[model samples]
Target: MEKAGLAEFNVKIVESCLVPPCLPSPRATLYLSNLDNQPLVRTDSNVLLVYEVCENVLPDPAKTIREALSKVLVYYYPVAGRLRKKEDGKLQVECTGEGVLFVEAMVDKSLSVLGDLDQLKPSFKQLLFRFPSNTAIEDVHPMVIQVNHFACGGFVVAVSFQHMVCDGRGVGQFLKGLGEMARGHVKPSIEPVWYRELLKPKNIPVHDLELTKEKIESTSDSWIPLIYKESTQMSLTLDFETVKYVKDGIMLECLDNCTTFEIVAALVWQARTRVLEIPHTQNVSIFFAVDVRRSFNPPLPNGYYGNGVVAIGAQAIAHDVINQPLSYLVNMIKKTKMSLTNEYLISIIDTDQFLLDIYSNQANIILSDWRWLGFNEVDFGSGSPVNICPIYWNENGPNISNGFVFVHSPKRKCDAFKVIVWMPPQEFNLLEIEIEAITNKYVVNGSNY
Candidate 1:
């Protein structure tokens, strides 16, 4: 008989490896997209997926997983290469197959000692994962994985990737392949596809849009996310009922319109604006990464394995955003999504400098939804992960970018959403109050309980 999960947090290293791709991939340079080269997006993407394996049920799980990774890399070979700048000053992966980093550690603790999974913080990451010394693309390994074994028989698997390589959905595909191989599947359910040529900028790049230029020029030094006056992070939990209430409330105002993302994002955008108390005349914007894989004229391959997303900007005056009703904000968000046409994507790709300008100077809120990434499917034989913590769990960690992430909460009794928000402490408190108040406003179906 054996206990499951973790028992405590005391940890120590046991094994490690520099696991390279099993087969040498062709030496080539994989290009980066305009969205990829943004100063804001140039951070190492790190994540922790925790699972509870029965005690001694599997021997040398680390080595076994490493072997699976090697095979997986043979197909997803670019991950094993290094990110370098070419003579043209563009970023690309030099497919030298230098190998990725994998580490195995043993912890004197168990999941029980770690306390609630939903309350995961930076300490949990520092203990269970192998964090890169820095977030620099050249400094940190583009890819790394850490396997930790707890005394109570549970283990945690963490993976860090260079953001320049792929987006979240792309990474999920790779992880799924790794899991399938670990489970004895020779090939992945969806074979790897790298169509980098599909997103190449058009000849004589077009920068004709006035809106793009206006939005790009809106950002001033006043709102630089880098300048902080006691910034903080808040990990919030929202149940399905509360979310429904929000949706319903917005529907009333918009005549059966608005999405959960729209409502929630509108609230967050407005709340942050309110908290910041910026001048009414000043301009503000919200940024979202639109998945253009399907929006392209000739859609990308089903399993296209590159950064196939474009950054969309939603802008308005501070006064308008703050004074306008939530529906107004929601409508703006909806419009932004509706505007990501094939042509718009190419326009951004061609003269992405304008978009890049906005991204570099604006201190706007960047929200990326991770609920649909299917992280639970990253099973490596023992069992599906009990919890999956997204990039930068807390404020003190590396690359605390001025962005927020939405993830599925591990709420036992019901479905819920967890929004990881990075903002000033005062704003977070205010946003918390606003969030509760907003949910309570239209709780027609027992949402307040």
Candidate 2:
């Protein structure tokens, strides 16, 4: 087998020649260039082994469209293995033998812009809905960049990634890197950095333990994982300016110090509670994924990749989040922001025993704000996306619906920050009413509704 040149390889030509039966299997050995070319991340040994697929089809040549996405994948070091604790409390990366586990690319006749922007919104949503069910944390690659031609003589580029691998901001960094590479740049926007050492559990003296034995036992027993039902739906873009004005109005009236995200999220949470009408006293938690690249010790180096994020959550009696004044809701969200500190993040990580304990608990609602996160910059040679949204998933048994809202700043004046909220049909309807009221209020105030 001929070894491909690292760092200076072209993806398109590689894809055409690297067909199956000749190319290395997707399960082939995973190696990092700086670390003895050893595998650092490995799949869970419990799952059934399956081939991973990467679809590649030629799009009408745009100045920037690459033939294959292999170049992008090659840049990131594959997880050779993960360090796990032994019975003696030592960490080790358990390496499993590897070959190309999976790699397959198909060219579909489906045009990227087979429908109008509004129509394309759902089409994109459907693509997200098609995420493979068997996705494991390890199988979920760090990045997947896709570019497809549209029937309208244009093209669309979409990137799907595992949330555990990178946050939305990290995705922006990856896209920027691809853009630089397509432009013939020798180096990425930021040099890639991998410091798994930062994730190592700290050594705590047994005599100085603050956690009680019962607390430790309870924490250990809390690992009982529960499954949840997940679904994804989409709404047309919301009036960004109007929504901002509405949020501002609510903030001013309530005299609260909450951000727009908090206000909007609170409104959605309240509406969801109304629709679900769960007992006001029931414990309800609302969590928003926060990018923590800057929250790490010595702060993650500019291009540090894998999963630089922490979930910032606000839990309270369902009634408080629902019936509380907008100001109060804003304060709750503000307080949540304070929890993004390094101590809190490390504490959470440490207390959870270095991620050994995974939280399978499902929140009634999870709101992801993509508007300010820069999803619009995901240009793959073609123009920006006409619409973008997230897919749904059922984790254990509890019904979990994911909502992603993005802003659409097109070349036109009428271009508003379009919001597409994905939720169960009934929940969406209730949210629609609240959104409409806010928009209507903006119109009454003579603002851009």
Candidate 3:
């Protein structure tokens, strides 16, 4: 037995054990050095993190799966902590703690279709929806990877984590390291880096960025769990060329340069707004996650493990959003993108001091774009998922309307992208005609269109 790998693993375990217990809450205390200058703040509120694991070895699957997860947890321990506020005005954790506090593992009975990536993707999503919130952070143990062997002897591994500790990109890097370890490739080239000093708030005069105080206070209303009615899966293939055509039409009409995500998102936003028929004076917001890896000074290491993204939103009145041409919508989206600069992100974080105040009067109508965010790379050993959908975990019922759109690689043609949207049934119906029109236009225009 090559003790070398074990020795290296032990080193990580010891380092995690030595992390100081200092924080207002476990969530806010742990900070990344690389994201020091940037606003990578964690909220006391919990977030769900999910991943799909593919494996080739299948004998005695349950035990094998558990063993793998156990080893992975040893590396992820320090990053697992709960967010808490102290009685005094200070923010820090009591320095007397050890072992895992906010990680768990459980079997999802629905993941039996491990061999079929298409079916497995959707099933995995539903699994995230059923995750319990009452589990003790101290007892929550990671490596809850589940093994569901398919009829063909292949198996899928689903690992869920709390987003309060790490961001998606951070988890992705961790999984890549774990995969290498499982494949007998230890001593990863990329070492994990922990830098909390950089994240400390600046003492100099902070700029006052202009944002709707009312909108900032209303995020709580937007946090409600989405309501779903008659959800079904559909598959369609639109290659990059077709995607480009649709994007071009939206840009030409909107009088602005819009990314593929912006165009598709504008379409969905318009469609949903139409169905909801919200009051003209009422505003709707489109929320999207922005990756801030490169936004930091010195930049995060390729192997950093933690949350490193921020949520940015664009708002418009219901009538303005619904009745606008695709081009105008695209322009609106473009402006929203430009507004998410470093100063804007910092201003948003500053508003966190009043989260409860803002969330109390939040309005309805929010959209999340998961298409261009690299969520489809969930490959266990079989292959990448044909479709990956997001599950809403908020406790409150839909606050009017909410939706998530994911772009997946087409099963028939890998080069093409397939867009699958999840939303309230009525909204889906309203957008059906416009969606078809866009698709039909793409077909008629062919590659050139």
In order, candidate lDDTs are 0.72, 0.45, 0.46
Name the better of 2 and 3 by TM-score.
3
Candidate 2 residue runs with Cα over 4 Å from true position: 1-74, 79-132, 135-145, 204-232, 253-257, 353-363, 392-415, 438-449
Error of 1 at 40 (Å): 3.7
Q: Record all residue pairs in model 1 with backbone atoms less than 3 Å apart, i.e. clashing.
A: 6-110, 6-111, 7-110, 7-111, 8-109, 8-110
Q: Pick the candidate with the highest TM-score.
A: 1
Candidate 3 per-residue lDDT over residues 39-84, each given as its tens digit? 2233221112223334544354434333433444445545433333
Model 1, residue 362: what's the lDDT?
33
Tens digit of lDDT per residue, candidate 2, span 1-449? 32221111111211211111121223333222111111111211010001111132224433243422334434543322223334653333333222112222232323322322332222233222122557644443333434433333434444445444345665666656655555456556576565555654464333333332332222222222234233344454555566666676676666654566776777666666666666666766666656676876668677766556554556677678667655566677778777666665555555442221113333345555666555555444444444444333333311234444544533343546544454555556777786566446645765632
lDDT of 1 by residue, 29-115 (tens): 787776666554566676777776654255667877899999999998888888887777668878888888888888776766554
lDDT for model 2: 0.45
RMSD of 1: 4.0
How big is the positional error of residue 154 in model 2, measured in Å on the Cα after superposition?
2.7
Listed per model in order, the count of residue pairs whose N, CA or C atoms clash below 3 Å is 6, 32, 29
Q: Which stretches of candidate 3 lie above 4 Å from their native place?
A: 1-65, 70-74, 79-131, 135-143, 212-214, 218-241, 254-256, 350-389, 392-401, 410-427, 438-449
Q: Candidate 1: deviation at residue 301, Å?
A: 0.4
